[model samples]
Target chain A: MIASARSWVDIYLTEMRIAIQQQLQYRVANYFYMIGMIAEPVIYLVVWTTVAEQQGGAVGGLDSGELAAYYIVWTLVRNMNIVFTPFGWENRIREGTFSGELLRPMHPIHYDLGYFAGWKVVVILLWLPLAAVLSLLFHPTATITPLGVVTFAIAIWGAYLIRSLNQSSLGMVTFWTTRVGPVFDIYFTAELLLSGRLVPMSLMPDWVQQIAWLLPFQWTFGFPIEALVGGLSPEQLLGGLAMQALWIAIGAVVLRRMFSIAVRRYSAVGG
Target chain B: MRAISLFLTFLRVGALNELQYRANLAIQLLESGISVFTGLVVLALVFSQVPALNGWSQPELLAVLGVYTLVGGVIGMLIQPNMERLITDVRQGTLDYILTKPDDSQVLVSVREIRIWRVVDVILGFVIIGVALVQLQGTLGPLDAVAFVVALLLGSAMVYCFWLLLTTAAFWIVRMDEIVELFMGLYASGRWPVTIYPDWLRFGLTFLVPVAFAVTIPAEALTGRLTPELLAGAAAFALALLLVTRWFWRVGLRRYAGASA
Candidate 1:
């Protein structure tokens, strides 16, 4: 068991190294993608900041400073939310590349996790200079407690895992139908609204907040941002992680079940 | 006269090709519906917190959104698909076939591909504007209506020029998928009036990308915020951009050595 566990570690490490090297070579392309993504939260920040200043310096209990912090931290969480998407799955199946992935000894999810985790290192590094510029422009303020920092570090990885698992399940749908754009659109729109990608959960209508609380969307986006900037208490911080683990468990089961079902339907000959 | 006929011919062919996929209309409807709903939700959320953003009321902002959707629909339906194909052709060296055609290359490349179902957005944008007008008490004057149309046309031209400039970057850059992302991101800022952004950002949206002209000026026309001076400036800038884009495309074309060579 010890030997097997060690081998798994080695596999993850080597795959991650491959990912880091491959991604670094495409720095300009990756930065272009990241810059495009940064536009989203920046737009949200500007709108809310405008509203807050107009409303005598507060909106939904968040001042412009706090809103700035919420959205600045938002950039990092959004980066973490990037994962192998259903579109990738569509390409793999259409090109008959999934057959190669299936022939591998380990589950393909391990490769995705290791690879994207490595990509996150590059994304985070690229994110720092962008974050500094945003801070200089937006004047974001945050009181980062030690516990909050620790929780944020862990929760971002948790956020990454939960999103990857969930999206992998969504990718499985591609095996059944190639024309899944509408389905993916619906999934993304839901995540955009419910996941605090659009605004802080507090700014949402009460019923929307209640719904987000039950769903896994907030765990991947809202919880991490709030853990850092919202100054959540110890219990709330740890509890969010616990909820993330639960969702991760559910997502893994759904994905594994989906993989089995999808593989049975996936009869594409190798490329 | 020839250019008009050329565009109509390609338009008909593109429409007929897409019409075969009857289900895409439904898919487009679903996606457009979701998008419009999301836009309204965001508007509602913003207005609920404050009566107006900056100086504009809820209805005024809705008009801005309508213009944004309308402009985006027009681009997606016509401009975007053609530009994207141009980029792909440049990369694959198939643009040689386009160059060999008798028609003007610029006009030919601009009108080649159309996604017909995006008319859904174009129509919805008008409906949203209609609704916003209903909520506002004042009637749109005859002059305002004419100005709106002029501004809308000018805005579209500016956006087309901007896209041509960006797509022309493919002559050097090669992989232009990221340009689409960059455009989409910057274009999204038009949902709010460019005036709401900081001066630096607003400047970028105006001169750097021309999204301000695309979505905002027509919106300003409807909302009674457009000054003649602004319209004049937009027209002058657009004219300059057209001349520059024409020159730039020609220069880029000179650099293009097709696959045969």
Candidate 2:
């Protein structure tokens, strides 16, 4: 068990290093992708700010500056939400790549987890300048506390784990059907509405906020953004991390069960 | 005349090829339906907070969303598929095949591929517009209908030119997939009126990307917000962009080395 634990750390580090190198080489493409994503939050910021200005500088209890803060941090959280897509799984299974992956000593999910975690290092690095630019343009006011900051840092990684587990589980659906677009699209639509990706959940209707509370989506986007944008209190800040941990635990169990079943269906024809 | 024939021929072929996958139509319908649902939900969220968003009512914004869907559908069906192929052909040097064709390479490349199922969004867009027009207090006048059509055509032309110009850059920039991501992100901004955006972003959407022309202008025409000056300016800008794209395509072509080279 001790030896296996050591090996797992070694494997993860090696995989993450490889990912960092590979992602660095594709930095220009990554930057283009990041720039593209920036538009979403900026558009939201502009619209909400305009709305706030119209409604006596506040709407849904958030001022224009707070809205700016919410959306500016949104760019980072959105990047965190990026995962190995189900479409990728469809391609992997169809192209026979999954066969090669299955032959490896490790489970394929670990590969995605470690590699994307390293890519997150690159993503965060690339995000700084973009965030600076957004800060300059939008003037986001973050009263981020030390405790809040700590919670946010941990919650983001927890968010990453929960999302990766869920998405990989979803990706397993491709084993059954290649036409996963409809399924994936429905999931994305749900995530968009429930997650703070579209708008802060607080701004949503009371029932919508209640729905978001029950789901894992908010722990990924809303909680993380709210953490840094200084929305959560001390208890809520810590509570959000606990919620993320609960979701991660649930997600792992679900993914493990689904993967076990799904792998049986994978005939691995491409190899 | 030759270009028209070439476009129609390819359109038919593309439609027939895609027709075999009838399930995709359902998928496309669900996709567009989901999007329209979210669009309305966002509108509801906004309107629930305030009666109007910076002067535009909920129905007017729906008109914008309708036009956005229509223009997005047209681009997906016609422009994007071709432009994406152009990017791949550039990288692989397969553009030589299209270049050697007797027809103009630009016209040939522009019309070769169409995702016929994207018509789902076009029809859905018209439905939304119909619903919005019904909800709206004032009826759309005949003159406004003509103006809306004109603006929509010009807007589509501008979008086509914008796409062609971006695809043309593939000759210089080797990796171009991000261009699509970038376009989609910017194009999504058209869901709201350009007028509502900060001036810098509005300028970016209008001149940098021409999304303002694609969605907002047509919505404006329908909502009785179109000024003659604005429509005329859009016409001139579209013409100018077309000429610039044509010129840029030639310049980019000069850089193409083809596979044999």
Candidate 3:
């Protein structure tokens, strides 16, 4: 088992290296894409900072600097949790590429997970410079306590798993529907509203906040940002971690079942 | 006269192709409705926290939303689909067919694809604007209504010219989807007043992309904030861009044909 695990790790690293090199060839375009991502968060930060300043130095417990901190952390957490798996699955299903994957020795999910991890590593590295620029401009104010740091580390992994599994499941549904583009659109809209990407979940309406807390969206982005910047209580941090674990387990089970069903359906259709 | 006939021919073809998938109309409406609902909800959430956004009250913002939906619909219906098709044709060497046509190739390429379902967005935009007007308890007089229509026409012209210029660049650069994505990113900012953005972003929207004229100017007209200078400026810019893009399209076509030959 240990030897097999070592081999898998080696394979993953090799894939990561190849992906990184492939991305490096388009380094200029990737730089602009990173700029675009960073621009959205910065735009919101400036807007909220202006609002907070206009409201006499605080809006929803966030001063201008605090708002900056929140948004910068929000940008990092969002980058960390970014899952390119949905597009992968969607394109593969559309182009009948999944049949080729099914013929491979390994489960398709393993290759997808590896690809996701590889792409994320590249994204995070690309984001580092932008994050630094934002930090210099905004002077984000956040205390990274030891506990908060540890929770953030764990939360990053948990967020990745939840996001990857959930989006993959959505992608798997393409086996049944041709118009799954709308499904992805709805998913994106929901995430924009609920994931604290557009605004802080705490600042949204009471009902929206309540709904956001019940779903995995907040755990994917909001909780980690809050924990890193606002410093969550021990109980809250533990609870968030627990919820993230729960969602990951649920997502894993759903993904497994959906994959099996989709494969069966694909085979039945002679794909 | 020739352009009109060509446009009509393209329209007929587009309609016939789209009519075959009648169910798509319902699906398109559903997708557009969900998008409009999300826009309203986001506006509602933002305004719930603050009564006004940059001197524009909720009703005024709603008018802005209406303008956004309308302009987005116009782009989706005609400009985006054609530009996308133009890009694919350029890539696949099929734009030669358009070039060989008896009429102007640019005109043919620009009107070849139409998404008929996007009329829903335009209709919904009018409905939302009407609702916002009722909420404000304000009457749009003849002059204001005419100004609004004029601004809307100018905005549409400006957007079309801008799209033409962008797609023309695809003749030289193969991967122009990034440019489209950049436009979408900037277009989202049109949901609010341009004045709300910082000076740099405001300039980028106005001069760089002209999204300011596309959505905000028409909303300004509806909200009785239209200035004569801004109106004249939009008209002049639109006409200028239309001429410039025509020239640019010709230049691009020459380059494309030269490269292929």
Candidate 4:
């Protein structure tokens, strides 16, 4: 079992290398894409800063500079947590490219994982310079306690797993549906609302905040963001981690069932 | 007169091509419906927190949202689909076929692709704007109504030129799609009042991206807040951009033909 695990890791790393190399060839477009990614967060940061100032230098326990830090961290975490699974899988399914993936010895999830790893490396490298520029411009203030740092580390990893599994499961639904663009659009709309991408959850209505807490969207983005900037109790950190694991398990089960059914349907349809 | 007739003919052909996919109309309706709902709900949530956002009341903001939906629908219905196809055509060398056409290549390329279903968003926008006007107890005088129409036309012209210029960049840059996506990212911020944003961002939306002129300025007319200077500025900007984009389009065509030959 250990030897098999090692081999799987080696294969994943190799796949990641190829994906990275392919992405590197489009370096110019990739830089522009990075700028596009930062634009949304910057817009939100400026608006929230304005809101904070209007409310006399703070909104929901966060000052303007703290809000800046929160968004900067939010930007980093969002970039890290992003998984391009749904559209890629749906396109593959529609174009009959999934057959090639199915013919491979490993599960298709491995390729997605490798692709995500490669993309994350690119994002991280791109993020450093952009984040540095934003920091120089905005002067975001962050006070990271040791405990907060540790929790943030765990939360970021948990957030990534949750996002990957959730998106992959959504992608697997392409077997049953012809058009997944609407589904992806709706999912993005939900994330924008509930994941604290547009605004901090505390600033949102009470009902929205309550709804966000129950869903995996908050765990994937908002919770980690809040934990990073605002101090979280150990118990709350543990609860957040537990919630993340629960959602991850749910996503995994859904993905496995959906993949199995999709494969059966594919064989039946002879595609 | 001849160009007008030719443009209408191409539009008819485009309409017929879109009619073949009737299901896409339903998809477009569903997508636009969700988008409008999300926008209204976010607005509702925001107004619930603050009674007035940057001195604009709820109804006023709803009018802005309506304008945003209408302009967005118009673009999706005509401009975006064509420009998107233009990019793909340029990349694949199929734009040569367009260049060979007897009619104006730019007109043909610009009007070739239409998603007819996007009219639903435009209709929905007008309905919402009407409802918001009633809610606000605002009377639309003939002059105000005319001003609104003029602003809408000017806004549409500006957006089309902006899209044309951006797509023309494909002549120089191989992957201009990222730039288009950046426009989309920037455009999403137009849902809120530009006054709420900082000056730099406001400038970006107004002059750089032209979202403010597209959505906000028209809604401002409806709400009786649009200054004459702003309207005139929007008109002048639209005209200038139209001319500039036309020139750029010609230059891009020349470059494309030169490179291919």
Q: State the lDDT of candidate 1 residue by residue for A84-195, as single tens digits.
A: 9999999998889888988999999999999999999999999999999999999998888999999999999999999999999999999998889899999999999999
Q: lDDT, candidate 1, residue B217? A: 92
Candidate 3 lDDT over residue span B4-74, tens digit each = 88889988998899999998887888788888988888787667667776788889989989989998999
Better of 1 and 4 by TM-score: 1
Q: Please identify model 1 stretches exceeding 4 Å from their true place.
A: B259-261
Candidate 2, residue A177: how far the Cα is off, in Å: 1.2
Candidate 1 lDDT over B12-83, as tens digits, reads 999999999999999999998899898999999998899999998999999998999999999999999999
Residue A42 in model 3: lDDT: 68
Clashing pairs in model 4? none
What overall lDDT, based on C-alpha atoms, would model 2 receive against the true structure?
Answer: 0.90
Worst 10 residues of 2 chain B by lDDT: B252-261
lDDT (0-100) at residue A257 of candidate 4?
88
Worst 10 residues of 2 chain A by lDDT: A262-271
| Top TM-score model | 2
For each candidate, what TM-score against the reference?
0.96, 0.97, 0.91, 0.93
Question: Best by lDDT, which number?
Answer: 1
Q: DockQ order of candidates, best first?
A: 2, 1, 4, 3
How far out, in Å, is residue A84 in model 2? 0.5
Q: Give the per-residue lDDT digits (tens) of candidate 4, residues B126-194.
A: 998998999999788887888899999998888888888888988877666776666677777777778
Q: lDDT tens string, model 3, A68-167?
A: 8888877768767777556677677777767788888777776666776777777778778877887887788876788998998789878988998898
Task: Judge candidate 1 at residue B78 and give its lDDT.
Answer: 93
Candidate 3: true interface contacts recovered: 0.11
Indicate the residue-level lDDT of A117 in model 1.
91
Error of 3 at B14 (Å): 1.0
- Write model 4 residue lDDT over A204-240, tens digit each, in one string: 8788898988899999998888777766787887888
